[model samples]
Target: MNTFKTEIVKTKEQSKTLAIIVVVLFIIANLYIFLIEKENQNVYLKSISFVIYFLGLFFLFGQSFIKPKPIGFFEIADTSINLRLDESQDTLLFIELDNIILKYTGYGSWWTHSIYGNKNYLLIACKNGENYNLEILLRNRSMKNDFKAFLNTEALQEKFQLKKTKNTTCEF
Candidate 1:
């Protein structure tokens, strides 16, 4: 009888924006140090700044090549999970809970997975030998706790294997 809904958060876009801001600031600082502050030059400090600036540039440009993930909604009910990733009609999907063989949720590794973020992906392996990957957005602590509790409930526990891992791996 429990139900859960999805929330959209633009984490990748936020990261890319942060990288761009950092790169711009680094560029300004490097220019000030190399061109304006030439009278009191510190080689080590200047070299470190240059290295950091390049790293920022690399991150900023690297992010540009990755296509952004589309916004989506996951409606999880007692019997099924409804997926509506895009607004288009072709993007609708419905997965029956009874058919699920395995469910993987990330609850490990601080650097690779966040306790609450857009990166919290749910992997469902069905009895019919189909695997589906969907990003779940748990906006707050209460929501996250509730979702985990639901998955670990007696009914679902008997129906499927609930796995906690450092990260969810899905091959499409």
Candidate 2:
């Protein structure tokens, strides 16, 4: 009955915060190299800090792909699932989806699985031409559980295999 909408203003705020942190890190690196390191100029520490500074830039680049928040609107009705994306002017409705897989994307995905947490992207991947296959970012733990429960149960779950194998059928 509820729809999860993309909070554009929240995204903007997060982006601004990330930009500020990155800028501050770059400034700190510069300050350490020029002002603080006037004594010994420890090359190893400087190199490490420089790497950290570059990592901040890399994070900025990767942030778009690993969204800071849910980027699409998701609705888990009694029988079907609907995905609405602001990025694409399209509404993808699924009465019976082929596969509802939880895929992990990122470096060290296994470590993500084993240690930190499940970096699972809720993938509503269907077969050809429908082309409405969507990857939804999951931000909250409760919502992720709710999504899994909804998809793994009777109505919508009947269409999916839920196995690790690939299923090519698309009936939505």
Candidate 3:
């Protein structure tokens, strides 16, 4: 049996700086659209505007203190795999290796696109039952491979009575 752990990597200072710049731009845009333009904004648009503003402010103020959470862990017995979530884990739609459906490369690209040219990710279903993609973003790929092998072991399956779903996929 092998115990596997996964943690969310913290954003770098440059990332934080960029986020701040984005928030500022968003604020400027909203001000222009709402106050300056005097465009006939409805309640729905107002609500959305407020939400975006709040998020930007939250990120700006909270970036210095907020830390990434450990989202996942896996334990493999002979026939079954146990996936555990840490207390700090955010709610993800799903976690499996084969869920990845696409790949691309760019700096600060969408979660659906791998930052590194050849990297890949698993597209977990969202809480809304839609496919929500998450980048693999593993700091140590070799360790992840070892953990996957342990999860696939036969002994673990029998011990945990694991259930297999056909919809999931994992890509490296």
Candidate 4:
């Protein structure tokens, strides 16, 4: 059995900058709607602006205050892999070795990189209709390499067959 600790990256300076921009937009939108548009009676425009600005403010608060925390444990045993990602749940994932159908470095597009930093990630998909699209963050490059190597080892290969192609459909 092999055990490893997972790391979670904190929001970067870009998030702070985005948050500031959102705040400024929120204030300007509110001032315009309440001061000038009050007589215009643009009900739809006012409601839409309020919803958009409120969502922006929520995003800003989450990015500025909520800190990311690493998972408690990441275990790779002979038959199963275990992960404790959610603090509220006792065990976030307990997947059988044979259940995993795909593993790849996912979300490499420019847009994904712009939002989630330019870091490598592991995407795991299970057979029981589970798609774990979120990146599995590791400590460093070396550890990530080790984990990748382990996944390609004869022991794991004998346990499950990997799919040759990945789904590339982009849903809007």
Query: RMSD for each model, in Å, please?
Result: 8.4, 9.8, 13.0, 10.0
Instruction: Write one digit per residue (lDDT tens) for candidate 2, span 55-155.
Output: 87676554444434445565666655556566654444454355666553321222232122223345565544453444444444555555566666675
- Per-residue lDDT of candidate 1, residues 72-111 (tens digit): 6766666566666567322222343433333344322233
Q: Candidate 4: RMSD over Cα atoms?
A: 10.0
Q: Which is better, 1 or 3, measured by TM-score?
A: 1
Compute each candidate's TM-score over C-alphas.
0.49, 0.44, 0.28, 0.39
Q: How do the residues 77-111 of candidate 4 rate in per-residue lDDT, one tens digit apiece?
A: 44456655567322223443333443433322343
Model 2 lDDT vs. the true structure?
Answer: 0.51
lDDT for model 1, on a 0 to 1 scale? 0.56
Better of 1 and 3 by lDDT: 1
At residue 87, what lDDT does model 2 achieve?
Answer: 66
Q: Clashing pairs in model 4?
A: none
Error of 3 at 27 (Å): 15
Q: Taking the tens digit of each residue's C-alpha lDDT, what string does model 3 give over 10-37? A: 2334476777787786786579456854
lDDT of 3 at 83: 42
> lDDT of all the models against the reference?
0.56, 0.51, 0.43, 0.49
Candidate 2 residue spans exceeding 4 A from truth = 1-71, 87-96, 104-119, 125-129, 161-172
Clashing pairs in 1: none
| Count of backbone collisions in candidate 4 | 0
